[model samples]
Target: MTAPATSSGIPVSRIDPYTDASILDPYHDYRALRDAGPVVRLDQYDLWAVARYDEVYEALHDHEAFLSGEGVGITEQLNKAQHGSSLTSDPPYHDTVRGLVSRHLTPKALREFHTYIQDWADRLVDELVERGEFDAVTDFGQAFPLALVPDLLGWPVDEGRERLLDWAAAGFNAFGPLNDRTRAGFPLLAEMGAFLHRMSVPGNLRPGSWGAELVADAQAGKIADELLPALLGDFLAPSMDTSVSALSSMLWLLGSHPGQWELLRQDHGLISNAFNEIVRLESPLRGFTRLLARDRSLGGADLAAGSRVLLLYGSANRDERHWKSPAEFDITRSNAAEHLGFGHGIHGCVGQALSRLEGHSLLNALLSKVRRIEVGEPVWRLHNTIRGIESLPVVLRA
Candidate 1:
């Protein structure tokens, strides 16, 4: 990492964060970016990238400076079209929509499904462990959410569930600039959005589920009726890939580090912290773009208004300056909760409570039944805006 070029020139790096190569394994480039400077101009994308923990955390909180309303993705078209989605909105409007969502995901609401997710994990793991070997991502990572989220949100359980995974992947993929990957994902995303929109209809939703609640709110004038579809669409797009990515990464980490698993086994209380540690170590979202609403300075880098900066959450989590032995995964890592795995500030993940509940239930269930976790080579799933294992093979011993 080099220092800033001069008072006139910002430190420039030609690394393309969206390229398949970088997305496959960004830690190397992330270290390079961090070492280069607090803020480095990505010449390829013509965007500023902040890799250090302090700066990224600050940017997430200072939304007025690093605005999300312009779009959080690399593409102009999708961002413009997604203006209605809460992910692309600013405060006031963002607060209203987020508040509506919070009503359904409060601790009490999320706690109701804890037993279900736990039992689901137990049943799924039992069958997989009996087989002696299985692809963790396909069998568990993808399956768990597909089985659970739709039911909770009132989407038809069987219909289009497979496409939901693809849609979730494409949602993040489309976040990047219009590249080969972005272009490739358009059709699937369009289709999935439409399907989810249909699922938002009051008649289509389960009588007492969250999706129905959104409709009820609309009818009661809580939120606009037209925004109902976008609200429901939000539940699927962000939740699926992120949750799947985190869950698979947890299994991989525990399997690879048996000593950590033993520690987790000794005390189930550590399950929550262990989940936080897993996500902190292997963040599902590589980063998201934030457009500068006005001329501002970030980490000493001066930027004009209407500039885009990539807040590298994944890199920030492993920043050496922030965490001791940042690369090592420890279940008992006290500061693990400080990691920006779920991000921070107002735009932070709204589905996080549900995600944690699912993680806790599944991880606790595994600790109780499985004695040893033998993991094989993991197939990587690369996307411009998300990082996760696509196929993780594991053999759980009783």
Candidate 2:
């Protein structure tokens, strides 16, 4: 099959990597890329975007064909000095580090944090119910999860929630072409990277926290000591942002559609499925990249080995090939569980269960106390990799 031609005359992705356009609203552009064809070469970054649903799933699933180690979000040359990490490597090296990561972040371990999770929810709801008004994104969605993750990781910071908020905004800046969006974030990225490196050191964590557990796992032959630092950075980097972003997106969905919210209020048991549907509606992030380990064919396109392909996760969830009337956000929709919001395959998100649990606990708490989430004029954050609303003003009529 012939290679998918790039939209040469019209730049495929002109949005600045560091600007609000990508962060504020990417749906229109994502639609453009998807409708253009299965694979569109981004003129700005000179990268390929796998826009169709089938192609993206194939890209992420065919690990043998698509390698992830060369760096997905950030270019290889930018981070070539980096050794290996679970996220950046393909197995068996990725498998090795990921095994250790999965151990600490596995289902059983997250269940152990259930007590802490419940406490965080109760505290946030308590604080917000008193005032009866707040920006759910920052006050709770963002603020609450941000507080939970760093505490569990034992990150060394007096104001970790605030600092991480800034750092996360700046962290996902290089997914596209370099522009003011990405260039302005270079300083923050460097500072955060250095700070994170220091925090990943064994000395930086409390003895009982997961960071220390990872250190011990390395000491006990679970993973290499050298890789442990990068592994720890993985947790700190994605944990708060993804979950919090998702939570914010969920609030946006629930608040905007009162009927669905009412349906959820009546059947509080559907909280789990509700979270999945929200992801189906507005995924936390659009895509992730995988390097082609070798030549492989997918979605009628024969991709060459070593080619970098973006797994358009957001597109996949909405793919007509997958879900019925995929565009509509139906909380009670059957088969909603099949969507790969957290991703699929061995490289799928390790902290997903933790994120899901947080989602359930927060949603359940809201349903128990409030009738509906009334939101107005929500503002979305500007970032290249992540997709989420930043401001969701709501007034709970308790």
Candidate 3:
């Protein structure tokens, strides 16, 4: 994977991460980027590719230097479109907007839903086990979250419920460069934005629910009325597709590695570490770009101010420099939680506690109900930013 060097000696590659071929099987290109250098210049997008663990971690932590306010997407238009959302903003404003939703997502606040989530998981597992075969992605992965998140956010049972997955996936796609995949997402995103606007109004959201709280906040002049829709989306999108991706990947990994399944079954306590390990191996989000706020040297590559750099969280999790035998999946790996699968620092995923609860509940239910997991080949979905399975034939044996 020899790359041409710029006059500044930065290794350069024309690899387009958003290409259909690359999105389907990105690990090869990710490995190539990592091998080429710590910070390789992606000639195709004119963005710096930070694929190694150390560099990606540093960039995520130094939010001031590697700014998110400039927009994290690869395109200027999309970034501008996402201007007011928490995902694309930096501190003071970022902290204020994120705080409105953060209180509800914290571990302590979410404890009330523990039994509820567990019961749902058990019920879903029982149905899947009874059938003995089903598509893990649609049946279990997408099903679990779709059932839980909407009701939790107080979404109406009748309006636009079916399109959440598609909308959330498209929202992530808009983060990539202007290409067919990214261009195709704009319309869906517009539709989602419209739904969110309707959902954000008072009397539309169920009172006392997270969505309603945002409405109340807007009404009280805590957050602007226009920001309500984007804020609702911030809570909604991240809560769905990413969890679906991780949950589906969990089943695939456990089914493919029976020994790991047995290991998990034996000690049920390993469930938490196992979730971390799963995301470590199959990061749901391929990566998100960060704009350099100032001229900075990242991994020996001097990037100028206003430059965009893509931080590959998926690549960083599997970086050889950080993990021993990085590709090998071991639930017992003590440091699995250290993986950047959920990212790190201030910009780390705000809804992660809820995600962990969802994963833990499902895994615990699986451990008690099924003895063996038989899975056929997975049909991988090609999206700009989300790396997930579209379908996987699975048969569970009790």
True lDDT of residue 310, candidate 3 = 93
- For model 3, where is the 10-residue window of minimal lDDT? 342-351
lDDT of 3 by residue, 201-241 (tens): 78998877889988988989998888888899988888988
Q: Considering lDDT, where higher is better, how would the candidates rank from best to worst?
A: 3, 1, 2
Each candidate: RMSD:
1.7, 3.3, 1.0
Clashing pairs in 2: 18-181, 18-182, 19-181, 23-382, 23-383, 65-293, 67-291, 69-88
State TM-scores per candidate: 0.96, 0.90, 0.98
Pick the TM-score winner: 3
lDDT per residue as tens, model 1, 26-114: 88989999988898887667688899999999999998888888889876778887766677889888989888876766678777667
Q: After superposition, which runs of candidate 3 have C-alpha atoms over 4 Å from their true positions?
A: none
Candidate 1's C-alpha lDDT?
Answer: 0.84
lDDT of 2 by residue, 229-276 (tens): 678767765677788888888878888899999999889889989999
Give the Cα lDDT of each candidate.
Answer: 0.84, 0.73, 0.89
The pairs that clash in candidate 3 are none
